[model samples]
Target: MKKIETFCPVRDILSQFGDKWSVLVLILLEDRQVLRFSELAKAIPDVSQKMLTVTLRSLESYHLVARKVYPEVPPRVEYSLTELGQSLLRPMHSLIDWALDHKDECLK
Candidate 1:
C-alpha cells in the first residue's frame, strides 16, 4: 500500500490523547468496557467533575467514544469506546509499555 503524504504534524494526533485526563478516561473505559459518570469519577478521584465532562465531550466529538443516555426517573449516562476508539488501544498500550521499559532512562 502506498502511504499518502500530508502536511499535518504528529503533534496534532498527540494533542488529542496527550492530555492528562483523556488517556486516563480511555484506559478506564478500555478496562471496564463501559462506565457511568459516577463510576468514572469514583475511579479517578483526582479528575474534577468539570474536567471529566469536558474530556468525555471531546472524546465523543472526535468519534473515539460513545455516550449513551437512558431514559429513566433520574436519567442515566454511560460511556464506552467506539470501534474507532478501540483501534487506539494498541498504540496506547504500546506507548505505555515503552514508557514502562524506559522509565529509568526517562526519569534521569
Candidate 2:
C-alpha cells in the first residue's frame, strides 16, 4: 500500500477520543473504576443518552473500555477501563495539568 493509504495514527487516535464527551467518559471511568450505564449517565448530567452511548461505543471499540453483561432477569451491564486505558490516564493527567497551568494565558 502507498504511504497515503496508511491511516495517520495521531489523527485516528484523536478522532476516536477527542471530543468533550469521550474525555469526560474516560475520566469518569478512571475515577470510578466501574460504573453502570445509568450511573455514568447520572454522573454526567449534561450528556444525552445518545451521546453517552456513542462515546461508550467508541471507547469500547478502541479497547479502552470493557463492557460486561450479566444474564439476569433485567440484565446488568458495567463499564471499566482496560489496562491500556489505565496507562493512558498518566498522559491525560499531564495534558490536564498543562491545560490548567495555561488556562489563564490561553483564555486571554
Q: Which candidate gets the maximum lDDT versus the true structure?
A: 2
**Per-residue alpha-carbon lDDT of model 2 for 34-106, expressed as tens digits?**
9999999999999999999999999999999999999997999999999988988899889889999999999
User: Which residue window of length 10 is worst by lDDT in model 2?
Assistant: 1-10
Q: Please write out the lDDT profile of model 1 over residues 2-108, one tens digit for every residue.
A: 34445255657678767989999999999999999999999999999999999999899889999999999799999999999999999999998999999999999
RMSD in Å for candidate 2, one decimal? 3.1
Clashing pairs for predicted structure model 2, backbone only: none
Q: Which segments of model 2 are wrong by more than 4 Å? A: 1-7
Clashes of 1: 0
| Cα-based lDDT for every prediction | 0.91, 0.92
Work out the TM-score per prediction. Answer: 0.88, 0.90
User: Which candidate wins on TM-score?
Assistant: 2
Looking at candidate 1, the ten consecutive residues that score lowest on lDDT are: 1-10
The residue pairs that clash in candidate 1, if any, are: none
